[model samples]
Target: MKYGVYLRPKPERAISGDAYTIREAEGSVLLGLADGLGSGEEAARASRLAVACIEEHASLPLVEILQRCHFALRNTRGVVLGLLRVDLQAGQVRYAGVGNIGIYALTREPFHPISYNGIVGYRLPRVHEFVAPYHPGDLFVLYSDGVNGAFHGNEALLRTEEDPQEIAGTIARLYGRPDDDVSVLVAR
Candidate 1:
C-alpha cells in the first residue's frame, strides 16, 4: 500500500499532540493514529507513546495491540487511537479504534468504520474489530478529530492516481483549523 501523512499543531502551539505511523508488518501494512486528550507536550507524549507501542507490537492482533497501548499508557494522559491492517494480496482490511478518530474507505461508495466509544488508556470497554474490502486503487483515509468533520476532498482527486502525500496535504489545508491540532493520513 502507498500512504502519506500530515500533521500540524494549533496555531498558538509550537507542537502537536497528535501522532501517527505507517509501516509494513509481516504480510500486511499497519496504520496507526493517536490523538492525546489535549493539545500540548503531555498530549504529544501520550500520542507518541501510543504510536510507538503500536509500532513495536505491529505483529499482534488488533485487540492485543490496543491492550498493550492501554497498559503502556496507564501512567499518562490517555489518547484516542485507531489502528488498521491491510493485506492487499488477501483483499482484506482489519481495523480497531477508540474515540473520535475517523477511518474511511474512499471508494465510489465510501465506507466509514465506526469507532467504539472510549479512550484508549483511561476508559475503554471491550474493543471491537471491523473488516472491509481492500482494493488496489481504493483510498483509505484517517484523521484526528481536529480536522473539520465536514471537509471531504474533491472526488476528482481520488479518481486520479495522485500521490498519497498530495491528498493528505490537500485535506489538511482545506479542513484544518487554527484552534486545534490536525492530522490527515491517506493510503492507496
Candidate 2:
C-alpha cells in the first residue's frame, strides 16, 4: 500500500519550527518530521538538519541513522525528530523521535500518540529502537513544534484522514499561526 503525507507549520514571514518529508519506494518507505528549537531561522535550521540525516540514511540501520544525526547536531542547538520506517514486504514499522516532534498511530483508536524518551541535542544518549506492526489502512500522523496556536506542539491524525498529503496541505493552510513553522506528514 502507498502512504499519504501532510504537513502544517506556524508563521508566515519565515518557516521556522516544523520540518517534514515523505519517501515511498518499492519495498521501503520513510517519513520524517523535525522541530527546530525556536521560531525563525534557528528553528528551521535545526529541523532541516534533523530530517536531512533521516532522508540520507533511510537504508541504514535505524539506531545508527539516529546516532549519526544526533552527533551531527551536537555542535548546534538541539532539535526534535519524528521518523517512521516501513518495510512494505515485511509489514512492519519503526517509529521514533526526540523533543516535541510527535507521532500518532491510527489502528482501531482515534488519536494515539507514540511517546519518545529523550531530547535530541548536545549530550543525549541514543534512542532505543521501537517497532510496531502495521496494516494497510493504518494511519500515521507526524507534526512539528507548536502547531498554530496550540501549546504542546501540533497533533497527528491517524484514525480519521485517508489522504495524508491533502491533510497536510490543509492543515498548513488552515491552522498555521502567523508566527512559527508548522509541518505535518501522514502515512499509512
Candidate 3:
C-alpha cells in the first residue's frame, strides 16, 4: 500500500485539532482521522486521544474501535472520527465514521462512503460499517472538514498524481481553510 498524510493548524494557532493514523496490521492497513470538537490545545488533546484509541484497538472491528474511542475521550472535548481498514488479503475495504470527516474512493467504480452524525465522545449515534471491493490500483482519501469538500471535484488530480504525498499536499494547500485545522490522508 502507498499512503501519505498532511496536517495543518488554524492560522493563528500553534497546534492542530486534527490527528490521523495509518498502520499495517494483521493483513490489513488501518487508516484513521479525528477532529476534536473545537480548536486549540484542548481540541488537539481530544483528537490525539482518539487516534491513540484507534491504535490501541487496531485489531478490533471498526465500530468497536470507535466505541472504544468514545469511552476513552469522554472527559475531553470529544471528536469526529473516520476509520478505514483495507484488507489486502480479503480484497476489500471497510469503513466507519462519525460526524463531518470525508472518505472518497478512487477506483473503476468510485463512490463516497457515508458517515454517521454526532460527536465521538459526547453523542455517538449508531455506528454503521461499509464494505466495498478493493482493487489493486484503487486510491482512497480521507480528510477532515477543515478542508473544503469541493476538493473532491478535482478527480483528475486524484487520478493522475503519482505520489500520495503530493496528492495530500496539493489538496491541503488548495482547499484547506485558514480558520480551522486541516488534515488529509491518501492511500493507494
Q: Cα RMSDs of all predictions? A: 1.6, 4.0, 1.0
Model 1 RMSD in angstroms: 1.6
The TM-score leader among the candidates is 3
Give stretches of model 3 more than 4 Å off: none
lDDT of 2 by residue, 50-127 (tens): 778777877776667667788878766777787778787897778766666666666533434454656576645556
lDDT of 1 by residue, 6-113 (tens): 999988888899999887956689999999999999999999999999989988999899999999999999999999888877978888999999877775444567
Error of 2 at 95 (Å): 0.7
Give the distance in Å from residue 30's predicted Cα in candidate 1 to where it truly belongs.
0.3
Best to worst by TM-score, what's the order? 3, 1, 2
Higher-ranked by lDDT: 1 or 2? 1
In model 2, which range of ten residues has the least summed lDDT? 149-158
TM-scores of all predicted structures? 0.93, 0.78, 0.97
> Which segments of candidate 1 are over 4 A away from where they belong?
108-110
lDDT of each: 0.86, 0.65, 0.91
- Evaluate residue 129 in candidate 1 and report its C-alpha lDDT on the 0 to 100 scale: 83
Flag regions of model 2 displaced more than 4 Å: 1-9, 108-113, 148-161, 169-179
